[model samples]
Target: MPKDALISTQSRHRMTTRIWHWSNALCLLILLMSGLTIFNAHPRLYWGEYGANDDHAWMAVGSSQTMGYLRLGELRIETTGALGNWQDSQGRTQTWAFPGWATIPSHYSLADGRRWHFFFAWIFSVGLALFMVMSLWNRHIQRDLHMRRDQWRPSHIWRSFRAHLDLRVIRQTAGEDYNSIQKMSYIGVIFLLLPLMIFSGLAMSPAMDANWPFLTDLFGGRQSARSLHFIGAFLLLLFFLVHMVMVLLSGPFRQTRSMITGGEGKEPLA
Candidate 1:
Protein backbone atom coordinates (compact mmCIF):
# COMPACT_ATOMS: atom_id res chain seq x y z
CA MET A 1 0.00 0.00 0.00
CA PRO A 2 1.14 3.54 -0.66
CA LYS A 3 2.23 5.71 2.32
CA ASP A 4 -0.93 7.81 2.17
CA ALA A 5 -3.05 4.70 1.69
CA LEU A 6 -2.04 2.86 4.87
CA ILE A 7 -4.96 0.55 5.67
CA SER A 8 -5.16 1.14 9.36
CA THR A 9 -7.42 -1.47 10.95
CA GLN A 10 -7.80 -1.23 14.71
CA SER A 11 -10.56 -0.57 17.25
CA ARG A 12 -10.42 1.86 20.15
CA HIS A 13 -14.03 1.55 21.30
CA ARG A 14 -15.03 -0.98 23.93
CA MET A 15 -16.96 -4.08 22.88
CA THR A 16 -20.06 -2.88 24.70
CA THR A 17 -20.17 0.45 22.89
CA ARG A 18 -19.89 -1.28 19.55
CA ILE A 19 -22.62 -3.72 20.50
CA TRP A 20 -25.04 -1.11 21.80
CA HIS A 21 -24.40 1.26 18.92
CA TRP A 22 -25.49 -1.21 16.27
CA SER A 23 -28.17 -2.76 18.41
CA ASN A 24 -29.71 0.60 19.12
CA ALA A 25 -29.47 1.47 15.49
CA LEU A 26 -31.41 -1.64 14.58
CA CYS A 27 -34.05 -1.05 17.22
CA LEU A 28 -34.42 2.53 16.12
CA LEU A 29 -34.97 1.35 12.57
CA ILE A 30 -37.73 -1.06 13.50
CA LEU A 31 -39.36 1.39 15.86
CA LEU A 32 -39.39 3.99 13.16
CA MET A 33 -40.63 1.66 10.43
CA SER A 34 -43.44 -0.02 12.29
CA GLY A 35 -44.35 3.22 13.95
CA LEU A 36 -44.63 4.88 10.54
CA THR A 37 -46.67 2.03 9.14
CA ILE A 38 -49.13 2.41 11.96
CA PHE A 39 -49.22 6.15 11.70
CA ASN A 40 -50.11 5.93 8.04
CA ALA A 41 -53.32 4.14 8.96
CA HIS A 42 -54.77 7.21 10.61
CA PRO A 43 -53.59 10.19 8.64
CA ARG A 44 -56.45 12.27 9.88
CA LEU A 45 -55.66 15.47 11.71
CA TYR A 46 -57.67 16.77 14.62
CA TRP A 47 -57.30 19.61 17.05
CA GLY A 48 -59.05 19.91 20.35
CA GLU A 49 -61.93 22.27 19.62
CA TYR A 50 -62.25 24.00 22.96
CA GLY A 51 -65.94 24.89 22.77
CA ALA A 52 -67.54 22.44 20.34
CA ASN A 53 -65.45 19.39 21.15
CA ASP A 54 -65.02 20.31 24.80
CA ASP A 55 -65.96 17.03 26.46
CA HIS A 56 -63.83 14.94 24.11
CA ALA A 57 -61.23 17.65 23.71
CA TRP A 58 -57.71 16.32 24.13
CA MET A 59 -55.44 19.27 24.61
CA ALA A 60 -56.00 22.65 26.17
CA VAL A 61 -56.40 25.60 23.87
CA GLY A 62 -53.19 26.98 22.33
CA SER A 63 -51.54 23.56 22.79
CA SER A 64 -51.27 21.85 19.40
CA GLN A 65 -50.12 18.65 17.71
CA THR A 66 -49.36 18.54 14.00
CA MET A 67 -50.63 15.21 12.72
CA GLY A 68 -49.21 14.11 9.39
CA TYR A 69 -51.01 12.94 6.26
CA LEU A 70 -50.31 9.26 5.85
CA ARG A 71 -50.76 7.07 2.81
CA LEU A 72 -53.39 4.35 2.68
CA GLY A 73 -52.98 0.50 2.93
CA GLU A 74 -51.23 0.58 6.30
CA LEU A 75 -54.29 -0.46 8.29
CA ARG A 76 -53.72 -3.27 10.73
CA ILE A 77 -56.30 -6.01 11.35
CA GLU A 78 -59.34 -5.02 13.37
CA THR A 79 -59.70 -6.20 16.96
CA THR A 80 -61.49 -4.90 20.01
CA GLY A 81 -61.34 -5.26 23.76
CA ALA A 82 -62.97 -3.69 26.78
CA LEU A 83 -61.98 -0.15 27.58
CA GLY A 84 -62.53 1.54 30.91
CA ASN A 85 -64.47 4.75 31.51
CA TRP A 86 -64.26 7.07 28.51
CA GLN A 87 -66.20 10.08 27.35
CA ASP A 88 -68.59 9.61 24.46
CA SER A 89 -69.36 11.84 21.46
CA GLN A 90 -72.41 13.34 23.15
CA GLY A 91 -70.22 15.10 25.68
CA ARG A 92 -71.51 12.77 28.38
CA THR A 93 -68.85 10.78 30.21
CA GLN A 94 -69.74 7.15 30.71
CA THR A 95 -68.08 4.41 32.72
CA TRP A 96 -67.84 1.42 30.44
CA ALA A 97 -66.70 -1.57 32.41
CA PHE A 98 -66.98 -2.98 28.92
CA PRO A 99 -66.04 -0.99 25.83
CA GLY A 100 -68.82 0.99 24.19
CA TRP A 101 -69.74 0.77 20.53
CA ALA A 102 -66.83 2.48 18.86
CA THR A 103 -65.03 1.83 15.63
CA ILE A 104 -61.36 1.44 16.52
CA PRO A 105 -58.93 1.86 13.67
CA SER A 106 -56.22 -0.68 12.99
CA HIS A 107 -53.65 0.34 10.35
CA TYR A 108 -51.87 -2.97 9.95
CA SER A 109 -52.21 -6.44 11.32
CA LEU A 110 -53.77 -5.36 14.56
CA ALA A 111 -52.50 -8.32 16.48
CA ASP A 112 -49.11 -8.10 14.83
CA GLY A 113 -49.14 -4.35 15.20
CA ARG A 114 -49.68 -4.57 18.95
CA ARG A 115 -47.18 -7.37 19.30
CA TRP A 116 -44.38 -5.86 17.23
CA HIS A 117 -44.86 -2.37 18.62
CA PHE A 118 -44.88 -3.44 22.25
CA PHE A 119 -41.97 -5.89 21.87
CA PHE A 120 -39.77 -3.69 19.70
CA ALA A 121 -40.49 -0.70 21.90
CA TRP A 122 -39.01 -2.49 24.90
CA ILE A 123 -35.85 -3.19 22.94
CA PHE A 124 -35.68 0.43 21.83
CA SER A 125 -36.10 1.63 25.39
CA VAL A 126 -33.47 -0.72 26.77
CA GLY A 127 -31.04 0.20 24.05
CA LEU A 128 -31.54 3.87 24.79
CA ALA A 129 -31.04 3.33 28.52
CA LEU A 130 -27.92 1.29 27.94
CA PHE A 131 -26.46 3.80 25.50
CA MET A 132 -27.19 6.69 27.82
CA VAL A 133 -25.67 4.92 30.82
CA MET A 134 -22.59 3.89 28.90
CA SER A 135 -22.15 7.36 27.47
CA LEU A 136 -22.21 8.97 30.92
CA TRP A 137 -20.26 6.21 32.63
CA ASN A 138 -17.34 6.36 30.23
CA ARG A 139 -17.63 10.12 29.76
CA HIS A 140 -17.34 9.17 26.13
CA ILE A 141 -20.15 11.48 25.10
CA GLN A 142 -18.69 14.47 26.93
CA ARG A 143 -15.22 13.89 25.53
CA ASP A 144 -16.11 12.87 22.01
CA LEU A 145 -19.39 14.43 20.92
CA HIS A 146 -19.90 17.43 23.18
CA MET A 147 -19.22 20.86 21.76
CA ARG A 148 -16.24 22.62 23.27
CA ARG A 149 -16.25 26.40 23.57
CA ASP A 150 -13.81 26.76 20.70
CA GLN A 151 -16.04 24.68 18.46
CA TRP A 152 -18.59 27.48 18.48
CA ARG A 153 -16.19 29.73 16.60
CA PRO A 154 -17.65 30.70 13.22
CA SER A 155 -14.45 29.88 11.32
CA HIS A 156 -14.15 26.49 12.98
CA ILE A 157 -17.80 25.60 12.36
CA TRP A 158 -17.78 26.81 8.76
CA ARG A 159 -14.66 24.79 8.02
CA SER A 160 -16.18 21.74 9.70
CA PHE A 161 -19.48 22.11 7.84
CA ARG A 162 -17.85 22.40 4.46
CA ALA A 163 -15.77 19.33 5.16
CA HIS A 164 -18.80 17.39 6.36
CA LEU A 165 -20.76 18.39 3.27
CA ASP A 166 -17.99 16.81 1.26
CA LEU A 167 -17.47 13.86 3.65
CA ARG A 168 -13.80 14.87 3.67
CA VAL A 169 -13.91 16.85 6.91
CA ILE A 170 -13.34 13.93 9.21
CA ARG A 171 -10.21 12.97 7.33
CA GLN A 172 -8.76 16.46 7.60
CA THR A 173 -9.72 17.52 11.12
CA ALA A 174 -7.11 16.47 13.73
CA GLY A 175 -8.30 14.85 16.97
CA GLU A 176 -11.85 15.52 15.79
CA ASP A 177 -13.51 12.12 16.03
CA TYR A 178 -16.76 13.72 14.86
CA ASN A 179 -17.12 16.74 12.62
CA SER A 180 -19.50 19.51 13.66
CA ILE A 181 -22.27 18.05 11.52
CA GLN A 182 -21.84 14.63 12.99
CA LYS A 183 -21.84 15.97 16.52
CA MET A 184 -24.97 18.04 15.92
CA SER A 185 -26.81 15.24 14.16
CA TYR A 186 -25.89 12.56 16.67
CA ILE A 187 -26.66 14.77 19.63
CA GLY A 188 -30.01 15.79 18.18
CA VAL A 189 -31.05 12.29 17.18
CA ILE A 190 -29.87 10.43 20.27
CA PHE A 191 -30.70 12.99 22.95
CA LEU A 192 -33.69 14.87 21.58
CA LEU A 193 -35.42 12.66 19.02
CA LEU A 194 -34.92 9.34 20.79
CA PRO A 195 -36.27 10.59 24.07
CA LEU A 196 -39.13 12.39 22.38
CA MET A 197 -40.11 9.21 20.53
CA ILE A 198 -39.99 7.10 23.66
CA PHE A 199 -41.84 9.54 25.88
CA SER A 200 -44.51 10.24 23.30
CA GLY A 201 -44.97 6.51 22.82
CA LEU A 202 -45.42 5.92 26.52
CA ALA A 203 -47.68 8.88 26.79
CA MET A 204 -49.99 7.12 24.36
CA SER A 205 -49.93 3.75 26.07
CA PRO A 206 -53.20 2.75 27.74
CA ALA A 207 -51.45 1.09 30.64
CA MET A 208 -49.41 4.18 31.32
CA ASP A 209 -52.49 6.36 31.18
CA ALA A 210 -53.84 4.69 34.30
CA ASN A 211 -50.79 5.38 36.39
CA TRP A 212 -49.53 8.60 34.92
CA PRO A 213 -52.42 10.95 34.48
CA PHE A 214 -49.91 13.71 33.96
CA LEU A 215 -48.69 12.04 30.80
CA THR A 216 -51.88 13.20 29.15
CA ASP A 217 -51.28 16.61 30.64
CA LEU A 218 -47.80 16.75 29.24
CA PHE A 219 -48.58 15.60 25.72
CA GLY A 220 -52.14 16.95 25.68
CA GLY A 221 -54.16 13.69 25.50
CA ARG A 222 -53.92 10.12 24.34
CA GLN A 223 -54.66 10.94 20.72
CA SER A 224 -52.41 13.96 20.91
CA ALA A 225 -49.71 11.74 22.35
CA ARG A 226 -50.28 9.46 19.40
CA SER A 227 -49.83 12.44 17.12
CA LEU A 228 -46.56 13.37 18.80
CA HIS A 229 -45.46 9.77 18.50
CA PHE A 230 -46.03 9.94 14.77
CA ILE A 231 -44.03 13.15 14.51
CA GLY A 232 -41.21 11.65 16.53
CA ALA A 233 -41.12 8.60 14.30
CA PHE A 234 -41.00 10.89 11.27
CA LEU A 235 -38.05 12.71 12.81
CA LEU A 236 -36.30 9.37 13.33
CA LEU A 237 -36.97 8.50 9.72
CA LEU A 238 -35.48 11.83 8.70
CA PHE A 239 -32.43 11.04 10.78
CA PHE A 240 -32.15 7.64 9.15
CA LEU A 241 -32.35 9.22 5.70
CA VAL A 242 -29.49 11.62 6.40
CA HIS A 243 -27.54 8.91 8.18
CA MET A 244 -27.78 6.63 5.17
CA VAL A 245 -26.71 9.40 2.83
CA MET A 246 -23.74 10.13 5.06
CA VAL A 247 -22.77 6.46 5.17
CA LEU A 248 -23.03 6.21 1.41
CA LEU A 249 -21.04 9.37 0.84
CA SER A 250 -18.42 8.41 3.41
CA GLY A 251 -18.18 4.79 2.17
CA PRO A 252 -20.44 2.27 3.84
CA PHE A 253 -17.78 -0.33 4.40
CA ARG A 254 -15.38 2.17 5.90
CA GLN A 255 -17.98 3.74 8.13
CA THR A 256 -19.54 0.44 9.16
CA ARG A 257 -16.17 -1.08 9.98
CA SER A 258 -15.08 1.92 12.01
CA MET A 259 -18.34 1.95 13.97
CA ILE A 260 -18.08 -1.77 14.59
CA THR A 261 -14.40 -1.82 15.55
CA GLY A 262 -13.63 1.83 16.15
CA GLY A 263 -11.39 3.76 13.77
CA GLU A 264 -8.39 1.86 12.52
CA GLY A 265 -4.81 2.37 13.76
CA LYS A 266 -3.64 3.03 17.29
CA GLU A 267 -2.21 6.35 18.43
CA PRO A 268 1.12 7.19 16.83
CA LEU A 269 4.33 6.96 18.85
CA ALA A 270 5.31 10.08 20.79
Candidate 2:
Protein backbone atom coordinates (compact mmCIF):
# COMPACT_ATOMS: atom_id res chain seq x y z
CA MET A 1 0.00 0.00 0.00
CA PRO A 2 1.20 3.48 -0.92
CA LYS A 3 1.41 6.35 1.62
CA ASP A 4 -0.98 8.33 -0.57
CA ALA A 5 -3.51 5.49 -0.56
CA LEU A 6 -3.41 5.29 3.25
CA ILE A 7 -3.81 9.07 3.52
CA SER A 8 -6.75 8.96 1.13
CA THR A 9 -8.75 6.52 3.27
CA GLN A 10 -11.35 8.08 5.61
CA SER A 11 -12.96 7.21 8.96
CA ARG A 12 -14.13 3.63 9.32
CA HIS A 13 -15.77 3.98 12.77
CA ARG A 14 -17.98 6.85 13.84
CA MET A 15 -17.44 8.54 17.22
CA THR A 16 -20.65 7.17 18.74
CA THR A 17 -19.93 3.68 17.38
CA ARG A 18 -16.43 3.72 18.83
CA ILE A 19 -17.70 4.87 22.23
CA TRP A 20 -20.37 2.18 22.32
CA HIS A 21 -17.90 -0.46 21.15
CA TRP A 22 -15.43 0.22 23.98
CA SER A 23 -18.16 0.59 26.61
CA ASN A 24 -19.79 -2.66 25.57
CA ALA A 25 -16.43 -4.44 25.63
CA LEU A 26 -15.82 -3.38 29.22
CA CYS A 27 -19.36 -4.25 30.34
CA LEU A 28 -19.20 -7.66 28.66
CA LEU A 29 -15.96 -8.60 30.39
CA ILE A 30 -17.36 -7.69 33.81
CA LEU A 31 -20.65 -9.45 33.13
CA LEU A 32 -18.99 -12.66 31.91
CA MET A 33 -16.58 -12.85 34.84
CA SER A 34 -19.25 -12.15 37.43
CA GLY A 35 -21.63 -14.55 35.69
CA LEU A 36 -19.10 -17.37 35.89
CA THR A 37 -18.62 -16.64 39.57
CA ILE A 38 -22.38 -16.87 40.06
CA PHE A 39 -22.47 -20.13 38.11
CA ASN A 40 -20.00 -21.64 40.60
CA ALA A 41 -22.90 -21.77 43.06
CA HIS A 42 -24.69 -24.43 41.03
CA PRO A 43 -22.29 -25.99 38.50
CA ARG A 44 -25.19 -27.79 36.93
CA LEU A 45 -27.84 -27.17 34.28
CA TYR A 46 -31.33 -28.57 33.89
CA TRP A 47 -34.24 -28.11 31.53
CA GLY A 48 -37.94 -27.34 32.30
CA GLU A 49 -39.32 -25.57 35.38
CA TYR A 50 -37.35 -26.73 38.41
CA GLY A 51 -34.02 -28.37 39.25
CA ALA A 52 -32.01 -29.17 42.35
CA ASN A 53 -29.38 -31.54 43.69
CA ASP A 54 -31.93 -34.36 43.71
CA ASP A 55 -33.35 -33.50 40.33
CA HIS A 56 -31.71 -34.86 37.18
CA ALA A 57 -29.47 -32.38 35.43
CA TRP A 58 -28.76 -32.25 31.73
CA MET A 59 -25.26 -31.01 32.46
CA ALA A 60 -23.12 -31.03 35.57
CA VAL A 61 -19.52 -30.44 36.64
CA GLY A 62 -18.58 -32.25 39.82
CA SER A 63 -15.99 -34.40 41.49
CA SER A 64 -16.74 -37.90 42.68
CA GLN A 65 -15.02 -39.82 45.45
CA THR A 66 -12.32 -40.85 43.00
CA MET A 67 -12.10 -38.17 40.24
CA GLY A 68 -13.70 -35.11 38.65
CA TYR A 69 -16.26 -35.40 35.89
CA LEU A 70 -18.36 -33.40 33.45
CA ARG A 71 -21.69 -35.06 32.79
CA LEU A 72 -23.59 -34.06 29.68
CA GLY A 73 -26.90 -35.90 29.65
CA GLU A 74 -25.90 -39.58 29.75
CA LEU A 75 -22.32 -39.10 28.63
CA ARG A 76 -19.74 -38.40 31.36
CA ILE A 77 -16.13 -37.37 30.87
CA GLU A 78 -13.42 -37.11 33.48
CA THR A 79 -12.20 -33.50 33.45
CA THR A 80 -9.95 -33.44 36.49
CA GLY A 81 -7.49 -30.51 36.88
CA ALA A 82 -9.23 -28.58 34.08
CA LEU A 83 -12.86 -28.24 35.10
CA GLY A 84 -14.57 -30.29 37.82
CA ASN A 85 -11.89 -30.64 40.46
CA TRP A 86 -8.85 -28.48 41.14
CA GLN A 87 -6.63 -27.44 44.05
CA ASP A 88 -6.94 -24.02 45.57
CA SER A 89 -4.21 -21.65 46.81
CA GLN A 90 -4.04 -23.41 50.22
CA GLY A 91 -3.89 -26.81 48.52
CA ARG A 92 -7.55 -27.45 49.33
CA THR A 93 -9.62 -29.42 46.82
CA GLN A 94 -12.20 -27.22 45.08
CA THR A 95 -15.07 -28.05 42.78
CA TRP A 96 -16.70 -25.31 40.76
CA ALA A 97 -18.57 -24.72 37.50
CA PHE A 98 -15.72 -22.70 36.02
CA PRO A 99 -12.11 -22.48 37.19
CA GLY A 100 -11.22 -19.78 39.75
CA TRP A 101 -9.08 -17.97 37.16
CA ALA A 102 -12.14 -17.64 34.93
CA THR A 103 -14.35 -15.82 37.43
CA ILE A 104 -14.41 -12.41 39.08
CA PRO A 105 -13.47 -12.23 42.82
CA SER A 106 -11.86 -15.61 41.96
CA HIS A 107 -13.42 -17.18 45.03
CA TYR A 108 -16.82 -18.24 46.37
CA SER A 109 -18.94 -15.17 47.04
CA LEU A 110 -22.40 -15.42 45.50
CA ALA A 111 -23.51 -12.10 46.99
CA ASP A 112 -20.58 -10.15 45.60
CA GLY A 113 -20.89 -11.93 42.27
CA ARG A 114 -24.59 -11.08 42.01
CA ARG A 115 -23.94 -7.45 42.87
CA TRP A 116 -21.30 -7.10 40.16
CA HIS A 117 -23.42 -8.97 37.63
CA PHE A 118 -26.56 -6.87 38.19
CA PHE A 119 -24.70 -3.55 38.26
CA PHE A 120 -23.03 -4.22 34.91
CA ALA A 121 -26.19 -5.84 33.55
CA TRP A 122 -28.02 -2.56 33.94
CA ILE A 123 -25.17 -0.72 32.22
CA PHE A 124 -25.03 -3.25 29.41
CA SER A 125 -28.80 -3.14 28.85
CA VAL A 126 -29.14 0.64 28.99
CA GLY A 127 -26.00 1.19 26.89
CA LEU A 128 -27.21 -1.23 24.26
CA ALA A 129 -30.65 0.40 24.08
CA LEU A 130 -29.19 3.89 23.73
CA PHE A 131 -26.71 2.73 21.11
CA MET A 132 -29.49 1.09 19.09
CA VAL A 133 -31.68 4.20 19.22
CA MET A 134 -28.77 6.44 18.27
CA SER A 135 -27.78 4.10 15.49
CA LEU A 136 -31.29 4.15 14.06
CA TRP A 137 -31.61 7.92 14.39
CA ASN A 138 -28.22 8.49 12.71
CA ARG A 139 -29.07 5.95 9.96
CA HIS A 140 -25.91 4.00 10.90
CA ILE A 141 -27.89 0.76 11.09
CA GLN A 142 -29.55 1.41 7.75
CA ARG A 143 -26.55 2.69 5.78
CA ASP A 144 -23.71 0.58 7.18
CA LEU A 145 -24.94 -2.48 9.04
CA HIS A 146 -27.98 -3.50 7.03
CA MET A 147 -27.56 -6.16 4.40
CA ARG A 148 -28.47 -5.18 0.87
CA ARG A 149 -30.76 -7.20 -1.42
CA ASP A 150 -27.77 -8.32 -3.49
CA GLN A 151 -26.13 -9.61 -0.31
CA TRP A 152 -29.04 -11.99 0.23
CA ARG A 153 -28.19 -13.87 -2.95
CA PRO A 154 -26.76 -17.38 -2.49
CA SER A 155 -23.84 -16.72 -4.81
CA HIS A 156 -22.98 -13.50 -3.00
CA ILE A 157 -23.08 -15.25 0.37
CA TRP A 158 -20.94 -18.11 -0.93
CA ARG A 159 -18.42 -15.63 -2.29
CA SER A 160 -18.31 -13.81 1.03
CA PHE A 161 -17.83 -17.10 2.91
CA ARG A 162 -15.03 -18.12 0.57
CA ALA A 163 -13.41 -14.72 0.98
CA HIS A 164 -13.52 -15.10 4.76
CA LEU A 165 -11.92 -18.55 4.50
CA ASP A 166 -9.23 -17.02 2.28
CA LEU A 167 -8.84 -14.17 4.82
CA ARG A 168 -9.67 -11.65 2.11
CA VAL A 169 -10.91 -8.38 3.55
CA ILE A 170 -12.15 -5.98 0.90
CA ARG A 171 -10.70 -2.57 1.73
CA GLN A 172 -12.93 0.47 1.42
CA THR A 173 -11.41 3.63 -0.04
CA ALA A 174 -13.69 6.44 1.20
CA GLY A 175 -17.41 6.15 0.43
CA GLU A 176 -17.60 2.38 0.53
CA ASP A 177 -18.73 0.55 3.71
CA TYR A 178 -18.51 -2.82 5.48
CA ASN A 179 -18.69 -5.95 3.33
CA SER A 180 -21.76 -8.24 3.28
CA ILE A 181 -20.34 -10.66 5.87
CA GLN A 182 -19.49 -7.78 8.21
CA LYS A 183 -22.94 -6.29 7.74
CA MET A 184 -24.65 -9.62 8.52
CA SER A 185 -22.48 -10.25 11.59
CA TYR A 186 -23.09 -6.76 13.01
CA ILE A 187 -26.81 -7.09 12.35
CA GLY A 188 -26.99 -10.50 14.01
CA VAL A 189 -25.08 -9.37 17.07
CA ILE A 190 -26.99 -6.10 17.45
CA PHE A 191 -30.48 -7.36 16.72
CA LEU A 192 -30.51 -11.03 17.65
CA LEU A 193 -27.73 -12.30 19.93
CA LEU A 194 -27.45 -9.29 22.26
CA PRO A 195 -31.19 -9.00 22.73
CA LEU A 196 -31.52 -12.72 23.37
CA MET A 197 -28.77 -12.48 25.99
CA ILE A 198 -30.50 -9.58 27.72
CA PHE A 199 -33.88 -11.25 27.69
CA SER A 200 -32.49 -14.53 28.97
CA GLY A 201 -30.63 -12.75 31.72
CA LEU A 202 -33.78 -10.94 32.75
CA ALA A 203 -35.77 -14.14 32.62
CA MET A 204 -33.46 -15.73 35.23
CA SER A 205 -34.22 -12.98 37.74
CA PRO A 206 -36.80 -13.88 40.40
CA ALA A 207 -37.84 -10.23 40.63
CA MET A 208 -38.32 -10.10 36.89
CA ASP A 209 -40.46 -13.22 37.08
CA ALA A 210 -42.55 -11.71 39.90
CA ASN A 211 -43.10 -8.47 37.98
CA TRP A 212 -43.36 -9.96 34.49
CA PRO A 213 -44.29 -13.62 34.68
CA PHE A 214 -44.56 -13.57 30.92
CA LEU A 215 -40.76 -13.66 30.59
CA THR A 216 -40.57 -17.02 32.30
CA ASP A 217 -43.46 -18.26 30.19
CA LEU A 218 -41.81 -16.92 27.08
CA PHE A 219 -38.68 -19.00 27.68
CA GLY A 220 -40.70 -22.04 28.91
CA GLY A 221 -39.28 -21.77 32.46
CA ARG A 222 -36.66 -20.16 34.70
CA GLN A 223 -34.26 -23.05 34.31
CA SER A 224 -34.77 -23.00 30.55
CA ALA A 225 -33.97 -19.29 30.56
CA ARG A 226 -30.80 -19.99 32.58
CA SER A 227 -29.72 -22.59 30.06
CA LEU A 228 -30.41 -20.21 27.19
CA HIS A 229 -28.48 -17.48 29.00
CA PHE A 230 -25.43 -19.74 29.30
CA ILE A 231 -25.72 -20.69 25.63
CA GLY A 232 -25.93 -17.02 24.64
CA ALA A 233 -22.88 -16.18 26.75
CA PHE A 234 -20.93 -19.03 25.12
CA LEU A 235 -21.95 -17.81 21.67
CA LEU A 236 -20.94 -14.24 22.51
CA LEU A 237 -17.55 -15.49 23.73
CA LEU A 238 -17.12 -17.39 20.49
CA PHE A 239 -17.97 -14.24 18.54
CA PHE A 240 -15.44 -12.24 20.53
CA LEU A 241 -12.72 -14.81 19.85
CA VAL A 242 -13.49 -14.81 16.12
CA HIS A 243 -13.64 -11.01 16.08
CA MET A 244 -10.19 -10.77 17.69
CA VAL A 245 -8.73 -13.27 15.20
CA MET A 246 -10.22 -11.36 12.27
CA VAL A 247 -8.90 -8.08 13.63
CA LEU A 248 -5.38 -9.50 13.97
CA LEU A 249 -5.53 -11.12 10.57
CA SER A 250 -7.05 -8.03 8.91
CA GLY A 251 -4.76 -5.34 10.46
CA PRO A 252 -4.42 -4.99 14.22
CA PHE A 253 -2.89 -1.52 14.43
CA ARG A 254 -4.79 -0.05 11.48
CA GLN A 255 -8.14 -1.53 12.50
CA THR A 256 -7.60 -0.59 16.15
CA ARG A 257 -6.56 2.97 15.24
CA SER A 258 -9.67 3.34 13.07
CA MET A 259 -11.84 2.37 16.06
CA ILE A 260 -9.98 4.66 18.48
CA THR A 261 -9.28 7.76 16.35
CA GLY A 262 -11.51 7.20 13.28
CA GLY A 263 -8.46 7.43 10.95
CA GLU A 264 -7.60 4.71 8.43
CA GLY A 265 -4.14 3.24 7.92
CA LYS A 266 -2.55 1.14 5.21
CA GLU A 267 -4.61 -1.73 3.87
CA PRO A 268 -3.70 -5.18 5.21
CA LEU A 269 -2.29 -7.63 2.66
CA ALA A 270 -4.57 -10.57 1.89
Query: Which one wins on TM-score?
Result: 2
Q: Model 2 over residues 1-270: C-alpha lDDT tens digits? A: 654334334456667889999999999998999999988899888888788999998988887535688899999988987786887778777777677788887898999999999999999999999999988876678767878899999899888877777644433322245678778888998899999989988888899999999998998899999988888888989989989988877778877887899765334322
Worst 10 residues of 2 by lDDT: 167-176
The parts of candidate 2 lying over 4 Å away from their true place are 1-10, 89-92, 168-176, 265-270
Encode model 1's per-residue lDDT on 1-270: one tens digit a residue: 433223222344556678887888777766655554454334333433122333432322121122112222343222122222334556444432222232222223445546666787898888788888988776657756788787878899888777766646544443336666677888888798888888878876778878887876687766776767766766777888978887777667766776776766545212
* Cα lDDT, all candidates: 0.59, 0.82
Against the true structure, candidate 1 reaches a TM-score of 0.68
Candidate 1 positional error at 156, Å: 3.3
